[model samples]
Target: MNEYQKFREQIDEFMQHHPQSPLDEAHRLYFRGLFYYEPSPAYLVMATVTRFSAREPLVEMETSTGDRRRYRRWGRAHFTIDGEAAALTIYANPYEEDFFLPFRDATSGKETYGAGRYLDSHRPGLRQLGEGEIGIDFNWCYNPYCAYNEGYSCPLPPRENWLAIPIRAGEKVFHSSSR
Candidate 1:
């Protein structure tokens, strides 16, 4: 099978069988697969990264479970959907070189998770396109593990990352979160 298919299968397996899966036995019993919006080319974008100043302050982000987490404003990824300009902040772990992105679009409560979604930096969809550009495939976005289990502490998308436009790409809410 193709690499992407293999990767998806692996992720599905992990969700269903891995010890770290957010699902407890009761939830895992009925697990089928994640729901997703039909893949759209409109949301596969190459956004230019605008680095934040070294002195940019670290923001305290609220979490799904009422916890607070701090992340440095590493940079912003700017792109466009249709004719609407969009931008989202990229966060740094302060202790790690890795980057993170959490966002909420117009489709958030109605179509996706209410808590927002995440774009894994190491994923192919968020790959480095060039020196200061990164590919952001909305189809590859996924819900935080907190969506499934309240025990998980997931950072919510800050106001800066909330987009007015509806991004009808990526994973939608799982069976129980349709509300």
Candidate 2:
């Protein structure tokens, strides 16, 4: 199996057997496993980041639990997939040591989480792309805790991060039929 396949298997194993899994006991009993699109090389990229001006305003995003989290528009990463140009704004939360990327694509509400998925990478400290770029592997994207259980609050992706093209990669919708 490929590395991503192995990673997916490990995630399934954890969600199915780990006591600390977001899935409740009842759901775990009937859990089959999360779904995913066939791994696509197009969805993996090394993007060039354009840093935003320091004067950019900090934006507050609402969460599922009616809470707000603050994030600054740190920069934007530009890339293309399948001949379609796409870009996503990277946000920096002052409280965290990582850059946050919450995004939604055409696959949302159909093949993936409706509220979107998240990607995170360690902050390069200089507020610039590490090594002049950052790896953007959509295959590593994942649903938030709220996707498994509603008790957890997850920040919704901002409007700017919505992509017009389907990103046929990463975690798929979790069906809670057994529950």
Candidate 3:
């Protein structure tokens, strides 16, 4: 198998042991729709971010309720997508000091979740790889803090993070027939 395949295998094994991850029960259920710890066809994207930034904290994401809520944007970074080059952002907000991402794309509401998917990009995994680089494995992209349950504030994806192309990489929308 190739290197990417090997990495995916490791991820699958990890997921089985840590299913639902560090997220709550609801969040874990939401993530299960997008990923599982088993061998199957998975999308492994190797992309780089062109423009990157790290916000001190305090970011916002508009909600379906028509409210603009602010959350901590501690672990923010920008990168490219499939060599196309884009600025990807991540929110460092885990259950207990975690990082997250909530974004929208052209496919939002149509192809994928209207609010976009969530990615748990913890720092330790890539620290050994070096700086200004990240591997946004769609297999890991699930839903944001809000998708699972209520009362939790989440950092929405900025307008810039919206991808015009359909990722078709990670978990698809829960209610969509396409999924």
Which is the leading candidate under TM-score? 1
Which rank order by TM-score, best down to worst?
Answer: 1, 2, 3
lDDT of 3 by residue, 1-179 (tens): 85434665565344334754334554444333333223323334434433323445465667645577665554444544445545556555423445555666655666566778766645222221245445555555555545544455555577756877656655445431111
Residue 88 alpha-carbon offset, candidate 2, angstroms: 0.4
Q: Could you arrange the candidates by lDDT from highest to lowest? A: 1, 2, 3
1-179, model 1: which lDDT tens digit per residue?
A: 75445656677788889999998888778787677777778889989998888787788999988889998888899999988999998888877757788999998989999879888677666776677888888878888999889899999999999999988887888775222
lDDT of 2 by residue, 12-103 (tens): 89998998899999888898788877888777787788888767777999898899988988788888888988899988886554688999
Which 10 successive residues of model 2 have the least lDDT summed? 122-131
Error of 3 at 165 (Å): 2.0
Candidate 3: lDDT of 107? 59
lDDT of 2 at 11: 84
Worst 10 residues of 3 by lDDT: 123-132
Clashing residue pairs for model 2: none
Model 1: residues >4 Å from true position, as ranges?
1-4, 177-179
Q: Give the TM-scores of the predictions, in the order they appear.
A: 0.91, 0.88, 0.54
Error of 2 at 10 (Å): 1.6
lDDT leader = 1
